[model samples]
Target: MRVGIAILSYKRCDITRHTIEQVQRHTKADHELIVVDDGSPDNTQNMLEELGVAYIRGPNCGVVWNKNRAIYYLHEMRHCDVVILLEEDTFPMEDGWEQAWIDGAKRWGHVNLAPSHWPLNDRIGGTGTVSNPIISRYVTGQCCSFSREALSVVGYLDTRFRGYGHAHVEHTTRFLRAGWGGYIKSGRDHNFYLIRSPLKVTCLDKPPPVADYSKNGDVFNSIRHDHIHRWCWRDEEEMAVFHTSFSTLSRSGIPVPTISKRQWFLSDNTDQNLVWDPETQVVISTPDKKDERPRVIATVSGETVQFKVLRDQTFWMTWEQPGEALLKEKRSEAATFKLIYGKNGGVGFFYNGLFLCTDHNFNDHIVLSRPEMKNWEVFHFSGFSDLEQPNNNPMRSDRIQDWPL
Candidate 1:
């Protein structure tokens, strides 16, 4: 039978690589492995290319849509008999691990190969030697398998669940309601080991940095029992969070009405952005938006944030002068700033306890003209995130590529 394996990956590059490499080296199943990347701003795209596997990298479209991308591609486009879904954190164990899942899917139509199981098979070293039935209404998306019949009847994941949490549960519940039989419990045998990796710094804009489960949970609870999905997922508040996640600011970007003296706001290309010349390593004073400029990147560790100017396709320098904002090629020249968050989903760059500002007025140049976390000092990073970048792209073909199936 033709097998299609889809792996869902987020911001963790090291863990993703470790998972994919394990699957590649151990599994002997005749399957096309496809990694679905949720527009990670890291080297995830670069890592996938080095692995020489098929992948689709798109913007932060939530966990529901992320899984659906792989499901739709593997099941609908590739016409695989059985499709296996895996997350980046799970590692495949032993050789030909796909056979048990294939056999299970062939028998049950759909099955969830539970990754985080009981203590018996929790750690390393367990062949999925035996198979047992899991009496569950829905299956988890961590590591699962589905037959063509299941895909044909159930379709892709319910995107109404939005980014994360209850999406998998709701989708599998629908399948079970349609008589897909009991989900698989990997028997006493475990195919994959779920490893918890450290969360690194990421530019995540979906499911929120810290997911508000109540909203999506209410969504799942509301429509879970309906035989048919005729109801729309958008309420006014839900739509704001669903469509443009940053439209509603998180508590971290909470309202600080007290210190906000001037009005801080989101920046776009329409804003008077600082244009840097790569050759001169200086910020161009020109107001023209058409001119080419190097990408300005920022990194955060602990409570300190450092800025870098991407030149010659490499991070070559730091902001040398606070007043002129000159990019200088020296690590020592790097300026560290503390984030003074504002009410309107922005932050004021507090360098050495002073706000980087423009004299409490929209000036042609930014200067160290403020001392507090006010409007003139505040600038939003969420406005310039990849969450809006790839999602705003009108073409799906631009983000997806044809890989060897």
Candidate 2:
């Protein structure tokens, strides 16, 4: 496949030159390099002429506009099979990097290959597939690859997105909705490096003036508003811990939620019976409630479980149980019974310690009663699977061996 590399450069001549050198050294496929100079004051055009690389120059338009212009030139003027976009700061690490994207495009027809450094921990910020491409509705434009078909269908980046913003995300969503497949290939480890410079100097030289999002609020607002499912910590303390955990997992590109003990809870009356050992990555919760009656009224094994906590408090567990028929009648009548792990390692209903085989299936609900606990708080856990053996798997627990990392 014919691959074209388009690097969007502003005033950073040194970084742009380095990126070009790296691409030439690592890429094995036949490719043409095009650098779009967005009216840079620096000697960028002169350097590109010296390096013998094709160039496109335009008036001082915004970054997104410059990017769209370059893409249009590559697609309409050059007629390349695939276009790989990179910023001056990003360099490729792997040999045959172009081939990886070409191969991916052959399989998925339209794929997005991004550099490894793109943050994936945030649901909205990772490499994704077309089936559920975006955990949240956002995509990074820093470094990405696109097949010719995708470019034709999605067109160029929306010019309304002026400075650095949601232009790429909006484009990706449009492509996915049109029945095209997208995949994120982990770019070479050392192939691409984000040029880290002093923010003060960089910002002063070319400060990103905030755009009036309200003016083009319709497009920007739709993307921002659709991202409500993206997870957020309730407070500052939780956010700090999340950041640290996220940083560690980011190295391998495996996306997971940043979980914390603060977000977990046990019965209020218990003597801190919930044990969490970070060193071991295990959590053990031993019941301390004396009433011991089942709090769940009904449970649908793979769907939902409705149970009472305090008289006014109710808890819902989304999962399926095995023996549901026995409890079907009791569930309809609002019978009180606790669901617990049975001796046979299956779901069992319990009332006062004797495993009660009630007509209603009460196998998966764990009942607890704490009169002092007034307000109910939602505890967030990652790696929850309704199809898995234990539906409510703890995030930081060794017991959850089959949990996806």
Query: Which candidate comes out best when scored by TM-score?
Result: 1
- Relative to the true structure, candidate 1 reaches a TM of 0.50
Q: Give per-residue CA lDDT, model 1, range 172-288, as digits (tens).
A: 665666666442244322222222211122222434333546667888888776653221112221111122221111222322221111111123222445445656545433345
Tens-place lDDT per residue, model 2, 1-405, is: 677888888998988888888888887888877787676779987888788776665444457656765676566557788777777776767676566555545444444533344354444332343332333323445556667776666665554455565565656655555444433335211111111111111112454435544444556665543421122222222222222222222222433233311222232122222222223322222344343432222321211123222223333322122222122223344433332321111223333333322111222222232222122211212221222224354533334343221
Q: Per-model C-alpha lDDT, please? A: 0.54, 0.45
Deviation of model 2 at 297, angstroms: 82
What's the distance in Å from true for residue 110, model 1? 0.8
| The 10-residue segment with the lowest total lDDT in model 2 | 190-199
Count clashing residue pairs per candidate.
2, 19
- The estimated TM-scores of all candidates read 0.50, 0.45
Highest lDDT: give the candidate number.
1
